[model samples]
Target chain A: MIASTSIHIERTTTPKAKPPQDKLGFGIYFTDHMFIMNYTADEGWHQSRIVPYQPITLDPAAKVFHYGQTVFEGLKAYKTADGRVQVFRPDANMRRMNLSNDRMSMPEIPTDLVLDAIKGLTHIDQDWIPDGEGNSLYIRPFIIATEALLGVQPSQAYTFMIIMSPVGAYYPEGINPVKIFVESHYVRAMIGGVGEAKTAGNYAAGLKAQDAAKEQGYTQVLWLDGAEHKYIEEVGSMNVFFKIDGTVYTPSLNGSILDGITRNSVIQLLRHWQVPVVERQLSIEEIYEAGKNGKLEEAFGTGTAAVISPVGELNWLGVKLVINGGATGGLSEKLYNNLTGIQYGKLEDEFNWMVEVK
Target chain B: MIASTSIHIERTTTPKAKPPQDKLGFGIYFTDHMFIMNYTADEGWHQSRIVPYQPITLDPAAKVFHYGQTVFEGLKAYKTADGRVQVFRPDANMRRMNLSNDRMSMPEIPTDLVLDAIKGLTHIDQDWIPDGEGNSLYIRPFIIATEALLGVQPSQAYTFMIIMSPVGAYYPEGINPVKIFVESHYVRAMIGGVGEAKTAGNYAAGLKAQDAAKEQGYTQVLWLDGAEHKYIEEVGSMNVFFKIDGTVYTPSLNGSILDGITRNSVIQLLRHWQVPVVERQLSIEEIYEAGKNGKLEEAFGTGTAAVISPVGELNWLGVKLVINGGATGGLSEKLYNNLTGIQYGKLEDEFNWMVEVK
Candidate 1:
C-alpha cells in the first residue's frame, strides 16, 4: 500500500543519445526510461523499477486481450524557462485515473504511488522534456489488467506503467480553428456507462464515428448523449467549452463525459479572473440557435494534449456553421496563455498547479 | 487484396511436450503456433505467418492501447471420432467477424485470408485439440489496430491474429442450470453504438456490471437495452433465449445485440426441427410475468465459447424465481445434445456446416 518503502532506479544506457526536443513526434518516440510496478493478488503492487524503454512481454491470454479491462490518463511534463521540469496538476489526473479504475473494477492506485511513478520515470527521462513554446514530454500513465485467466471477474493481477512520448504542438500550425462533426448516430458513453472515466473503451467506441467524420472532412467527432442523443456530451479526446455573451459555459460532469482536468482548470481560471462561468447541460439546438442569434461567440475543446483547439465550424445534421467570433477568441487565448504561463513558469503561480521535479 | 499467396510459417521450437486434457481451463492453455498477418494502408493484409506462440511487442502508443480499436470472434475446432479435425461453420464466423469489423471502422479481413489463417494455425496445432465429448480447440480470431498513433481514427496499420486455446467444457458439472443477475444499472451497448460488433470496448464496458453480478453470486449479467434498460439484450457473453409456452423467442438483432454464430445456429436448428421461434424485443417484465404465468418455460444463452447455458433463475428487481418446469428443460437438452452431436460427428452433417481442414 505504501510505495515509499521501495524504489529502485535503473538508468537508461542509450539515454536517447540525442535529446527528444530535436525529434518530437506525437507518440512515435519515447523517453529513455519508464516507471514499472506489478500488482498480484498475493503481494499487491511491488518492486517499483525505472526500467529502460523496451517492449513488454505479455501472455496471449492476458485478461486485457479478451476483455479490455484497462484505464489510462494523459498529462505532460513542461520544461520551464528556468530549466526546471514540472508536471501540471498530476494529482488531479491520478484522482481521475483511480475513479476510472473504480468504474472498471480495477485495483485502486494510491495517489502517492501514482505520483511516485510519475516522478520516477519523468526524472530519469527528464531530458526528453522539450523546451521552447508548445513543446513538452507527453506522459501517458495507464493501468491494465495483466492477469492470465479466462473467468471474467476483476483481474487479480494488474500492471501500471508510465510511458512518455516527446510531443510538439498539438496544433503545430498555430491555434488554427478546426471543424467538428456532430455525430448524431453514435454515442460515446451512456448514463450508467463508463464515459466519465478515461478508460480505453470510451475512446474505442468513438473510432468509427471519428473515421466517418474524417471522411466528411472534419477534425473530430462531437459525441452526443446516448439516452436522448439531443444533448452534447464531448468531442473526440477533449471536453468542450462554449462562450455566450461575455460568459463562459461548459458541460458539467453528467456521468457520460470525461471529467477533464484541463476543462476544470479553465473553469477555475475563468472564475479566478472574474469571468462568468457555467456548468450545465448544453444542447445542440441551443448552440445552433446561439450561433444564429449572434450569442455564441466561440467554441473550443480542452485536454492535456491540446490545451485549447478553437472550433472554426461545427457540422451537425447536414448543417454547417461558421462559428462566430473567429476560430481563436480573445478569452480563449487569454485563458490558454495564463494556463501555459503557470505551466512554463512564465507567470506567477497563483493556483500552484505545477509540481516541480528535482 | 488477394491472399492466394501462401504465408511463411515459423514453426514453434517449444511445442507442448504433452497437451493437457480432461480439465483444460478455458483460454488458459494455448497451442504451439498462432496465425498472424500484418496490414498497412499500402499493402493491405500481407506477410501472413504461422508463428511460434509468443508475446507480441506493441508500442505503448499503439492505437489499440489508447483507443480500443479492436474486434474479435470465437469459434472452435472439433476432433471427430474419425480423428479428422474440422471447424464448426467458420464461414458464418467470418461473416460476423467482418460485420463486427465494419461496425468498429476497421477494414474487413478478406474471406480468403480469414479462411487461410484459421486453417494455417489450426492445422499446425492440430495435436493440441482435446479428445472425447465436449472438448475442442477454442479458436479466437482477433483484429487490433496496431498503428502507433494517438489520434482517434481507424488505424492506418493493423495486425490480425488467430490464437487457439484448448478448452474442455464451460461448466465441468454436466451443464447444470445457472442463475443470472438481471443487470439494471450497467448497459452493454446502444442501438447506434458498437454493441453489435464483437469489439473490445463493448466487453470492457460490461466488466464492471459483470464484477458486481459475480459479487452478488450470479453466473453472468443479463444486460438490458440502453434506451429504457427494460429489454433483455444478451447475457454476459452470449445471446439469450426464452421459451414462452410452446413458442421459442429471443431478442431480435435490432442493431445492438450481437448476431452470434451459435445463436443463428440454434434458430436454424429449432426451425429445422419444426419448433416455432421468433426474434423480437423480449422485455424483462414480459418474460417475468410469463414465467409467473407458466408461459415462459425455458431460458438459455448461446455463443461460440459456451454452446448453450441454461438460465436456472433470474434475479430481477428482488424477484428471484426458478425457471419454469425444472433445472433443465427438454428442448434445451435436445438442442444442446443435437448441436454437440453434430460437432463431434455423432449426428449426420446434413447442413454442410463443418469445414474439414486440408
Candidate 2:
C-alpha cells in the first residue's frame, strides 16, 4: 500500500466557483479535484494521484462496459459548526467495499490506502462541503474494470476513483413520509447472487421495477426475496424496518440483504434506548395483517443518503396499506433527528462513530 | 426510423494492417472503422455516423461506470466463397437487444436503424473479415447510459456503438468435447431478474463461479435453477441441450435462461431433420441417471461464440458422469457441421437466416 505522504497532487488551474447552495441538487455538480489509482496484474495498485476532475477515456471494449464488473460506495463529508469537517463511519464503507470486490472477483483494496485517499481528497476539497442544514459533500468512490478485453472473465486492469459532489437534503420538503410500492414482480436478487454487495449489476437490474413504481406515483419499490417472493428483502436500495406493537423488526442478514451501515447504527441506537428490536424474517403478508388489525405502527428505510425515510403507505398488488395514517411516526422522527444531529456535530456522539477531518 | 441512406461515413486516414488469420483470437483485434449514434431525451437518437474505431470519452460520473446501465449484443459477419459478406440472423440480435433495452430502462434502437448500422459498418471494413476455416468477424453492438450523473436512476443520454473484431474458432483444438462443473453454489440469475436479457450484470455475477470451476480443472460451469437448484438453466454463457434415447432435450425458457439465437436455430434444424426435440425442465439427477444407464447419447451448449460445444463429462458434486466416453458424439458432430456449413455458405441455406451486406 502506498503511504499517504506519497500521494501526488496536481491542482487544477481553472477552478470555478461553487454552485449555489440552494440549487445544489444531488450529484449534478462535482468538485474541482478527484482522486484516482490504477491497478494491473504486472504492477498492483500504483500511481495514486489527485488531478482535475475531467472526462475519462477508455477503449470501448473495456470489461466494465460489457460485463458490468464494477462496484461503488457513497458517504458524505459534513461541515460542522466552527469550521470543522467530519466523515461518519468511513471504515464501515471501506470494509464493505472490499466485500464487494471479493464478490465481483476483483482484487482487495487495502483499507488504509482507501482511508488515506478519502482523507486526502476530502481535505483538498474541504471548501466544497456545504454548511447549510441537511447539506453535505457527497463522496462517491467507485472501481471499474479497465481491461480492454471482451470475455467473461475477471479483468486484469482496474481503476479506483473518488469524486465529490455538494448536495442538499434528501427530503427538500423536510423529513416527510414516502409512499412505497410493494413489488410482487421483478426480483432484485436471489441467494448466491451479488445482491449483498454494492455492485453495479444489482442496481441495474432494479431500474425497470423502480421506474414502474415511479410511474405509479410511488417513491420507491419495496423489494421481495427472489427465491420465495414472500419475504421482504429491502426498500429500494435501503434496508427496511417495521415498528409494530412497540417492537422493531428488520430483516436479518440472509445472504441476500446488504449489510447497511446506517441500519447497524439504528439498531445500536435503538438498543441503547431500550427499545425492543429484533432481526428476523418479516414477510409482507405479516405486515399487511398487522396493518389490517391496527397493530402496525411505523415503517422506515435506513441508508446513508436518507438516514431514515418513513414509509407512509404501501401499495401491494393494488391494496394500499396505510401506516401511521400516512404520517411520519414518532420513533422515526426521533431517530432521524438524533442521527442527523450526531452527523452534523450538534449532538454528543456517544458511539464514537464520527471521524473529523484535519 | 431513418433510412440506411442517411448514415454518413468518415474513413480513417491511417488504416491498421490486418492481423494474421491464425493469430486472431476472440475479441482481441478490431477493424479500422466503427458505427456510433447518440440519444437524448429531447432529440432521441441522432447523429448516426461511421467513424474510426477509437476510445470513447465519458464523464467520470457516467451512469454506466457506477450503476452498470448498459446492454450489448453479439453477432458475426462471415466471408463466403463467392466473395460476399453476410451476417447470420442480424434481425434476431436486434430484437433481443431491444428486449435488453426494455429490461434495463434504456431507449430502444429501431430495428431498421440497427440493421443499417451493421450493414454500413460491415461494408466499410469488409477486409477485416478473416478467411481461415471457422474464422469470422465478430460484431458487438452495445448501448451505455452516458449522462454524467451519480444517482441510481436511468440516464437521459445514451451512446450506441458497434465494433468489429476478427476471431478464430472458439476451440483452437477443433470442435472437441469439454468437461463442465455443475454449479450449485453461485447463481447466475433468478426468476423475474435480468437473466433473460443480455445485460452485463448477469455475466459479471457468473465470473466467481466460473473462475472457481476453472481452478478445479473444468472448462465451464453448468448453472442450475436459482430457487430449488434442481433444474438446469444454462452452461456457462450458452444455452444447454441434452440427447437421450434419440430425443434432444433443452431447458425451457423459464424466465431465467437466455433466449439464445443459436439455440433457436439448432432447434429448428433438429425439427427439420425429423429429430424429436423437447423443451422441458431437465433435472441434474435425471441426466446422471441417463448417463449411468448408457442412455445419454450427447450433450452440447449453443451460443454465438461457440456454435456447438459438446459436453463430454459433467462433474456434479464430485460424481463424474461421462457421456460417450469423453469423445464427441455423432449427433453433436452433425449439428455442428450443419450449423457451420450454413453460416459459412458451404451448405444450402434452407432456412434463409443469412442477410447479405450490400
Candidate 3:
C-alpha cells in the first residue's frame, strides 16, 4: 500500500491551452493533471499518483455503475490579490467526506492523505485558476466502488480521485435573486436514507423535480420534508436560510439535510455579528403566511457553488410569494459580500477559515 | 440512430470456457457476448449492437460516477427440461426499468427494443445456460448517464447495456428457512423518494444496514418505512410476504416498496388457488403480536434472485420470534415448488408469464 508521505507524481508531456477566463463555466474545462488512489480489500489504498487527466476503464459489472456506490466533495481554490493561492475550509470538506463515507458504507480516506493530494494537485495546476472576477478552480474529490461484481453489498475494491475545473461565477448577471418552485410531488431524501451523505443517489433523486421546475420557468426547486412534505428541507443544492420578523432562521440538521461547510460558516458569522440567527424547522406554510402578513424579510441559500443565492419569488401550488419585491435582501447581499471577500483574502479572516495552498 | 430492428452483432473471435455447472454461483461468471446501446440528446438511442463482453472506458467526470444517474433490472433466462430457453415476465421488468428511468429524469427506451435485446442476447448465449439444479443465466440490463459533466442535473448522454451471468440456486442447502433481523435504525427509502424505482441509490442506501445485519448473524435485514419506522417495507432486496391466521398478506404498493414481479406473480397464483390474500400496510408491532399469539403461520421474501426465501426467525429489538419452529412453512415450500416448477416448464403456466426465447 502506498503511504501518505510517498505519493508518486507523473507529469504530462503535453499540456493543453487553458480556456479564456470569461469562458470558464462550471465543470466544463479540466486541468491537465489529476490525483488518484486505488483501494482493495487486501491491500487497502495504494498506488497514489498524480497523472494527466484521462479516461478510466472498468469492468462492465463494476458496482458503482449499477449500485451507485459513490460519494463526492466540491470546493474551490481561490487566487488572491497578492498572487497567492488558497482554499476555503478544505479540512472541513475532507472531514465531511469521511462522514459521508461512513454513511455510505465505504472506507474513509486518511485526512492527511486527502489534504496532501488536494494541496499537491492545486499547486501543480495553480495556473488554471481563472483571473476573472468570481472565477476560481473548482476542486472535485470523489470515491467510487470499482469491484467488478453484480451484487448489493459493499464493494471489495474502490478508487479515489480528485479532478479540477476552472469555473465562472454561478450568476453572470451579478448576484441576482432567482425564482424557485416549491416541489410537492417529488422528494429528494428522507430522514433515515443517505440524504445527509454527499453521495450520488441524493443528487439523482432531485433531478426529476429540478427538471419539472425548470420547465415551469423556475431557476431551482425548494424541497420539503419527505414524510409530510410540510417542513422545508433545502433549496436546490444548498442549505437555505429565511429571515422573518427580524430574526434569521435556517433548517436544523435533522439528519436529512447536508451539513454544508458554508452553512456552518454562515451561521458562525451571523452569530458573531449578532444577527439573531436560529436553526429550527421552518415550514413552507409558515413562510407563505409570513409573506401574506409582510413579515417575510429575506431568504437565501448557502453553498460552495453560489456562496449566497438570493430568493426572488417562490411559487407554491400557484400561490406566488414575492419577498423583498422580488429583489435581493440587505442581509443576503451583506453575507455574499463578506463571504466572497473572505474567500478572496480581502476581508479579515476572523474565524480563520482560509488555508493557503502553498 | 439505430432502431429496434436494426441491432447489429459482432461475434467474438475466441469464445470463453464456460464455468462448471456445479461451481457457478450468482453474478460471478459472465457470458461471452453482451448487448449495448447509446443515447444522446441529439440522437436519442443509437448504435445498438451485441459485442464481446469487455471493460467499458469512461471519462472520470461521467455523470454516473458523480451523481448516480443509473438504473438496472435483474431477470433470469432458464433452460427448461425440453431444452428450450425461456425468461419469465421479462416485459414486466422492462416496464419497471422505464418507470425507474422516468423517476431518475432519463429518457425511456422503447419496450420493443429492450425485449429485442434481451431475447437476442439470450439466443446468442444459449450455451452459457448452466445445466444444474435451480441454475439459470442471470440477465442484467442497466442504463447509466455517460455525459462527462460534474453538475447535479440530467445527463445529455446515456449508455444502456445488457450483461449475463450464470448462477446456481440462491441457497446451497435448498429452500430452507433463514434468520432475519428487523431493522429499526436505517431505512432503505420513504414515500415520495426513489424507493419504488429500481435505481442504484436505493440499493446503495441498504448496504450499511445489511452489513450490520450480517454481523448480527442474520441473513437479511427487514427494512421498515422511513417516516414512521413502523410499517414493514421489504426484506433485504426482495418484497416480503407474511401469513397470519389464514390470509396471505404482503405490503401494498405504497410508493415506498418496490413493485416486485415475483410478489405480483405469487399474489396471482394464490388468488387462482382460492387462497385468501390481502395487500395492505403491515406493521412490525402487529407482526409481533401475531407471533406472540401463535397466529403467524409463514413468512417469506419474493424477488428475482431468491424466488421465495422463507423466514425462520426474526430478531427485532432483542426479542427473537421463531416461526414454524425454525423450519420452512408448508405454504412457503409449496410456493417455492410451484414457482420453480412453472419456471422450469414442469407445471402449467396458467397465467402465460413465461416468454420462450427463440
Candidate 4:
C-alpha cells in the first residue's frame, strides 16, 4: 500500500480494510474513508479532507431541506483482473457534475479536484473494489447548501462530499431483462429546467411515479417529456437506449435527460463497433410501433450502477410491448458484454477510459 | 407556562410570561421550540417530537442530499391587540402544504396533526409573536427525505419539521416597491411539473436566474412558462398581480404557478373591495403593451412572509416600464394594510380567518 511515505500526504491514518467481496447491497455499504470539502462565499473551497465515513449534522433550517439546493453524481470503480482498481471515465462524471452544480446555482467543483478526491478515496478503499462480474465500488459525489441562515438567497456556505459504497452485481445471476412502466401522467422533466442536471430534486420528483410503476409489477418507470408526454425521456435512474434495424438509437440529451456517464460510454462503444447511431427525439409511439412491427429488437437503460439494464417489455397506458420474453435481448447482451469486458480489463482499453489507482 | 411537571400539564416554565409587543422582522429569529416527526417505509411516521431548537444530524447519503425530496409552508402567529396569540388563514397553508406533499409523493401530514403541531409549537413560543402592524411570528413548516440510502427511491425515511423564525415586517418602513427582471431564457416552472407544489427544488432551480437578476439591480426574476416564454408565471416565490385599466389581472392558476395562500387571500380581499380579478394568461408582452398604452396601472406579488410586495417598475430587455415610482402603489398599500391588519389583529378579524390560541 502507498503510505504517507510519499510527500503531499496530509493527515494519513489507515484503518483495517475489509475484503471487497462481501457487500451489504449497492448503496447500503460504504467504504472506510471519504473525501470532503467545504465552500463558503468568503472561502472558495476550504477544508478538504479524506476522512472516515461519518454522518453530517445540519441545521434544521438549512436551505437544502427547504430549497432543494443539492446535486450529485454516480460512477464506480472496477477491480480489474490484475488487482488494479480502475475508474471508468471519471472525467465525464466530473464534467456532468459541474453542469449539475452550475444549473443548481451551486459552486463548481474543479475537474482536477474531482479527480483528486475520487482517486484519493478509491485508493483508500482499494480493498472495497470487489472482484467478479457486476461487483464494484459505487462512488457517489454530492454537494449541498450548508448555510445556517434561514433566508434563502443563494446559500453562502456549502459542503461537497464523495462517498464510496461496495455494490453487488445489479443482476446477481448474469444479465436479464426487466420490465418498465411508461409514465405518461407524471413527467420527469420539462424544457428550460434542470433536466440535464443530476440534481436531487429531479430524482425526488420521480419517486412517486416510480413507486406507482413498481406497484404495477415493473422494475422501473420510463419518464417522458413534460411538454409532450409522448416523447421518450429516460428510465427511473438511467438513460434509455434502443437497438433497431442493426443500428443503435437513444433519446437525444436535449436539456432534460441526464448526461449519464454510462450512456456516453455506450454511444462511444457503438460508434467504435462501426454501428450507425442516432441521438434524436425518440417518441413513445415510434417505440410502440417498432415493437409491434418486430423492428424493435432490444431496449435498455444505461447508468453507472446497472451498467446496462435490458428492458423486456414496456407497459405503457395499459398496453404491453414485449421487446424480449423477460430474457436479455441479443444486442443488449452484446453491449453489456462489451461494456463489462472493457471495465474489467478483459478487452483492450481502446479508448483508454479506465484510470488506474495505486 | 404549560409544560411537563410530570406528564401532561404541570406548568413547568415560560421563557417570558408575555408576548412581545413589537412588529417582527422576516425570518431573522425563531420560537423557542419546534415540532418534528420521522417516516420510514417499515415504520410509517413515528417519533413525533416538540423539541427545542436544535440541528439535525443526517447521513451524507440521505436522499435529501441528491434528490430534491423537500417541500415547505409559511404562515404566521400574531399577538392581537387584546393580547391573544392568533394565526390568520392557517388552514390554507396546511392545505397547500398537503398539496405539495402529494405532488412530491411525500406522506401527507394529517390536517389536524398539522394544526396540533403548529398549535403546540406556537403555544411554546407564544412570546415570539409580535403585536404590531405587519409584524408576526413567521412559522416555516417543511418536510424532507432522510433515508441514508444512496439509490433514488422515495427515501425510505423522511423528516417532517416545523421551525419558527421571528420575521421583521417584509417592508420594514411600510409598503415599498420592487423592480422585476423579465427573463426570456430561463423558465422557472413547467406544465405537469412541481410548479404548484411548494418544493424547495422550485426555488433552488431559480436561484441562479434570480441571482443574475439581482446582480443587474432587479429585485426578483419574473418567470415565464417553459413551453412558451411569452406567458408570465410568477415573480420569484410570490404570486404576481397586474392591473390593466381598473380591473386587476393575475395569471391564471395554472399548475406552473405555486398555489400560494397569500395569493388566494389577496383574491378574496380584491373581491371584497369589489375589484374585478381575472385569472387568465397575462403575457409579458401584454403587460408591456398595456403600459405603453397607459392601460397597465399597478403590479405586485403576494406571499405569507412578504404579504404584499409592490412592483413599481418592470425592466424587460432594456425597456423599462415605470408604472409607479419606487414606492407603494395605491392598490398595494390598501392590500398590505388590510391583510396585515387582519394578521396582527389591528382590524376586526372579519372572515373569521384568525384562530386564537390563548
Candidate 5:
C-alpha cells in the first residue's frame, strides 16, 4: 500500500478565474487541478498524483469506449461555520466504488489512498467550494479501462480520476415537491444484471425513460422490476421512499437495486427518531392502493446531488396519485432540514457523519 | 444530410510499420488513417474527415466516460482472389447502428456518408488487408457522447469515428467444435432494455459470466433470457442455431437479443438452398430433450468475428449434452464453407451482398 505522503503534486501554472457562486450550475465548471492514478496488471495501483485539470488523451480502441467497463462515485464537501472543510460519508462512497468495480470486473482501489486523494485535492481547491446555502463542492471520482484492446475480457490497464465542480442547489426554487412518472414499459435493470453497480451503462439505459417522462410533464421516473413491473426499484437514479400509515418504506437491496448512502442514512435517522422505517419489496400497486385509501402520506428520493427530493405526485398508467396535497409533508421537511443541516455543519454532528479534512 | 464528397482527407506523415499477416490478431493493430465526424444539436453530424490515427482528447467529465452514451457497429473488408477489396453487408451494419443510436438517444448518422467513409478509408488503407486465408481487415465504427457535463441526460455533442484493424481467423486451429456453458445466473438484457442495440453496456454485462465459464473449462457462455432462465438468448455475444430433425431452429427476434447480420445472412442462405429453417423460441430443456431423443443434429453460433462457430458439447447444470459425438457436424461445416466462399469472392454473389470498393 502506498502512503499518502508518496502522492506527487503538480500545481497548474495558469489558473482560470472561478465562477460566481450564483452562476455555478451543477457540473458546468471544474476546478484548476484534479486527481489521477494509474493501475496495471503488473504494477497493481500506483503512481498517484494531483495534476492540472486538462483533457485526457486515449487511443480510439480503449475498452471503456467500446465495452462500458467503468465505475464512479459522487459526494460533496462543505465549508462549516468555523471555516473548515468537511466531507459527508466519503468512506462510504469509496467502498461503494470498489463494490461497483468488483461487479464490472475492474481492479479495486485502496480506500485509504482514495480518501487521502479526495481530502488532499479538496484542501488544495478549497476556494472553489460555494458558500451559499444548499451549495457545496460536488466531487466525482471515476475509473475507466484504459487498455487499447477490443476483446470482451477485462482490461489490463485502468485510470482513476477525480474532478470537482462547485454548484448551486439542485432545487434552485427551494425544496419544492416534484411529480414523478411511474414507468412500466421501460425496464431500468434486471434482478441478475449490473443495475446494482454504479456503472455507466446503467445510467445510459435510463436516458430514454427519463426523456419520455420529461416529455409527459413529469420531473422524474420511478422504475419498476424488469420481471413483474410491479415492485418499486428507484426514482430517477435515486433511492425512493414512500410514507404509508406514518411509516417509511424503501425497496430492499435485491441485487438489481443500488445500495445508496443517503438512503441508508435516511433509514438510520428515521429509526433514531423512532419513526418506523422498513426496507423490503414494496410494490407499486400497494402504494397506489394506499394512496387511494388515504394511507399514503409522503414520498421522496434520496441521492448525493439532491439530499432529499420530495415527490409531490406520481402518475401510474394514466392515474395521478397526489401526495400531501402536492406539498412537502412535515416529516419530509424535517428530514431534509436535519440531513442538510448536518451536512453543512449547521447542526451538531450527533452521528459523526462529517469527516474533517484537516 | 452531408454529402460524401464533403469529407476532407489528411494523410499521415509518419507511417507505422505494418505487422506480419501471421501476427494479425483481432482489433490489436490499427491502420494509418481513420474517419471521424462530429455531431451537435445545431450542426447535425457535419464536418466529416479522414485524418491520421492518433489519441483522442476528452475532458474528464465527458458524458461517454460517465453515462456510457455510445453505440458501435462491426464489419470486415476482404481481399478477393482477383485482388479487389469488398465489404460484406456494410449497409446492414449502418442501419443497425442507427437503430442503436435511436435507442441510446443519440443522433442518427447518414448511411450514405457512412458507407462512403468505410469504402474511402478501406481504399486508402487497402495495403493493410492481409492475404492469408480467413484473414481480413476489420472495421469498427462507433459514436460517443462528447459533451463534458456531469448531468445524466443525452449529450449535445457527439464524435463518430471509424477505425480499421487487420484480423486473423477467429478459430486459429481450424473450424473445430467448442464447448459452451449454459449460464443461468447472470442476465444480459431485459425485454424492455437496450439488448437489441449494439451498445457497450450489454458487452460489459457478459464479461463476468464469460470469465466464470472460462474458469470452468468452457469456451464461451450461452446466455438465458432475463425474465426466466429457460429460453436461449445468445451464445457468447453471437446468435445461436440448432439443427434438430433436419431442420434449423434459432431464437426469434426478441427485444432482448441482438439482430446479427451474419445470423440473418445464414438464414437467407439456408432458405435460398431450400433448406428448412425456422425462427422461434427454443429453450434449453427442449435442446436437452432433443439430444437425449437422438434428434439434435448440429449446433453453431454466427457473428461477424466468427462466421460460424460449431458447438459440439453443452454443459447445462452439470449435465454434459454432447452432440454429433462431440465433433463438427456436416451441416455446420457446409454453412461455414459456403459463407466464407461468398465472403472471399470464391462463389457467385447471387444475393448481391458484397459491395466492392473501386
Candidate 6:
C-alpha cells in the first residue's frame, strides 16, 4: 500500500473555464485536476499523482478495452451551508470497491490512502463543488486493466483514477415520482456473475432493456433476477425498496444485487425510525398482488446518483401497479430529506458518515 | 453507409522493425498502421481512415472505461503456400459483430464497408503475416464508446478500429490435449444475457473462474448454464464438442453461447465427411455416463485463436473423466488439419470459406 504523503501534485497550467451552473448536468463537466495511480505486478502500486484532467492514452490491446477488467465507485461531495465541503461514507465505497476488485479478479487498492487522495483532490478543487440545492460534486473512482495482452487472464498492469464532475440533481424534476417498467426479457447479472461488482459490463448489458423501457415511456427498468424472472433484483442502477402494509421490504444481498451505500443508509434510517425493514426475496408478483390488495403503500430507489427516486408506477406484463396514488410517499420523502440532509451537513451526524475536508 | 472508396490512407513514416519469428506471440507485436472509423448520431459512421498505429486517447469519463459499451471480433490472416494472404470467415465475424452491436444498443455498422476495411488493412500489412505451420497474423476489430459521459446509456460517439498482430501457435505444443475443469459455482452468462455478444464484459466476467481453474492445474473452464447449472454452455472462450458412440454432439445455440465460426466449420466438415452431428442440450452427467461406458471417444474446443484444442480430461466435482487415454483423438486431429489446411490455402476450397486478399 502506498502512503498519502508519497502522492505528488502537479497543478494545471491552463485550467479551462467552468461551465455555467445550469449546465452542470450529470457527468457532463469535469474539474481541473484528477488523481491517478498505477499498479504493476513487479512494483505493486506507485506513481500516485494529481495531474491536469486530460485524456487517457492506452494501447489498443489493453485488457480494459477487450476484457472488461475494471471496477468503479460513485459518490458525491456536498457543500455545506457554511461553505465547508464533505463526502458521505467514503470508507464504505472504498470497502465495497475492494470487494468488487476481488470479484473482478483485480488487485485490491489501499482504501485509506485512496481516501486521503480523494480528500486532497477535493480540497484542491473545492470550488468545483456546486452550492445550489440538490447539487453536488459527483466523484468517480475507477480502475482499469492496462496490460497490452490479448489473453483472457487478468492483466499484469492496472491504472486507478479519480475524476470529479460537478452535476445537478440526477432527475431534473427533483424528488418527483417516475414510472418504471418491469423487464422480464434482458438479464443484467447472474448469481455467480459480476452483478454485485460495480464493473462496466453490468451497465452495458442493461442498455438495451433501458432503451426499451424508455421507448415505453418509463423512466427506468425494474430488473428481475437472471435465473428466474419472478424475483425482483434492482431498478436500473439503483437498489429498490417497497413499503407494504406499513412495513418496508428490500431484496437481500443474494450474491447478485449491489451492496449500495445509499441502500444501506436508507435501511439504517428506516430501522432508526422504528420502521420494520426486511431484506428478503421480494417478488414482482408479490408487489403486484400487494398493489391489488391496496397494501402496497410506497416504492423508491436508492443510489449515489439519484440519492432517492420515488417509483410512482410499475408496468408489468401490460398491467400497471400504481403506488401511493402516483405521488411520492411520506416515508420516501422523509428518507430522501434525511439522507441528503446528512450528506450536505444540514442534519446532525448521528452515524458520523461525513468526512470533512478542510 | 460509407464506401471503400471514401477511405483515406496515411502511411506510417516511422516504421519499426518486426520481431523475430520465435518471439511472435499472440497480440504482442503490431503492424505499422491501423484502420479507424468514427461514429456519431448526426454523422453516422464517417471519417474512415488508416493511420499510424498509436495509443488511443480518451477522456477519463469515456463510457468504454466506465460502462463497457464495447464489442470486438478476432480473426487471422494466413500466408498461404502460393505466397498469397487469405482470411477465414471474416464475413461471419462481421455479421456477429453487428449482432453484438444490436444487443449492446449500439448503432449497427455497415458490415460490407467494414469487411472492405479489414481486407484493405490486411493487404497493406501483408508482409507482417508470419509463414509457419502454426503462425499467422491475428487481427482484432473492436468498437469502444468514446462519449465522455457518466450516464449509463448508449453512447452517442464511438470508434471502430482494426489492429493487427503477428502471432505464433496458441499452444506451443501443437494439436495437444488440455485438462479442463467444469465450473459449477461461477456462471458465465444467462439465457437472456449478453452471452452471445463478443463484448468486453463477458470476458471480464470469466477471468475469476479461469483463474480458479488454473490454480487447480486446469488449462480451461467448462462453463455451465446459469439457470440450472446442468447444461454445458462453453469451454473457456471456445465452443466445445464431443464424439460419443460414433456421433458428434455439441451444445445447441441456446441464446447463451457464442456462435463460434470454427464450431460452424467443424460441423460442416463433419457433415461433408458423412459423419453424424447433433446440436442439442448436453448435460455433464451424460458426458460422465458416456465416459464410464467407454462411449466418449473424443472431445475438442473450437475457436479462432487455437482453431482446435482437444480435451483429454475433464474434472467435475472431484471426478476425473479422462478421454482417449489422455491423448489427442483421431477425429480431433483430422478436423484440426482440415481447418488449418483450408485456412492456409492448402486444402481445396470446397466450402468457399477462404477470402483471398490482393
Worst 10 residues of 4 chain B by lDDT: B1-10
lDDT by residue (tens digit), candidate 1, A1-358: 4333466788767666644454565777877887878888777788777788777767666777667888998899999887999999999999898899888888888788678879777887887787767998888988777776666567888888888988887756667788999999888888888888787777777877887888889989888888888888888889999898888888889888889899999998889989999999999889999889988898989988888888889988999888864568888788788888888889988888999888
- Candidate 5 lDDT over B286-329, as tens digits, reads 99999999999999999999999999899999999998998999
Worst 10 residues of 3 chain A by lDDT: A1-10
Model 4 per-residue lDDT at A268: 89
Give lDDT per model, in order: 0.84, 0.92, 0.92, 0.81, 0.93, 0.93
Q: Model 3, range B2-21, lDDT digits (tens) per residue?
A: 23447899999999999987
Isolated chain A TM-score, each model: 0.97, 0.98, 0.98, 0.94, 0.98, 0.98
lDDT of 2 by residue, A1-358 (tens): 3223357999999986999989998899999999998988877888888999999999999999899999899998898887888899999999999999999998888778788888889999998998788999999999999998897889999999999999988888899999999998899998888899899889989999999999999999999998888999999999999999999999999888999999999999999999999999989999999999999999999999989999999999999999999999999999999999999999999999898889
For model 5, the local distance difference test gives: 0.93
Docking class of 3: high
* CAPRI class assigned to model 5: high
Clashes of each: 0, 0, 0, 13, 0, 0
Model 3 Cα lDDT, one tens digit per residue, A155-241: 999999999999998877799999999999888888888889999999999998898999999999999998889999999999999
lDDT of 6 by residue, B1-358 (tens): 3323377999999988988988887898999989999998888899898999999899999999999999999999999998989999999999999999999988888888888888999998998998778899999999999999998889999999999999997776678899999999999999889999999999999999999999999999999999888999999999999999999999999888999999999999999999999999999999999999999999999999999999999999989999999999999999999999999998998999999999
Comparing 4 and 6 by TM-score, which wins? 6
Hey, what RMSD does candidate 5 come out at? 1.3
User: Candidate 4 - CAPRI tier?
Assistant: medium
iRMS of each prediction in angstroms?
1.5, 0.7, 0.8, 1.4, 0.6, 0.7
Pairs that collide, model 2:
none
Model 3 per-residue lDDT at A134: 92
In candidate 4 chain A, what residue range of length 10 has the lowest lDDT sum? A1-10
lDDT for residue B85 in candidate 5, whole number 0-100: 94
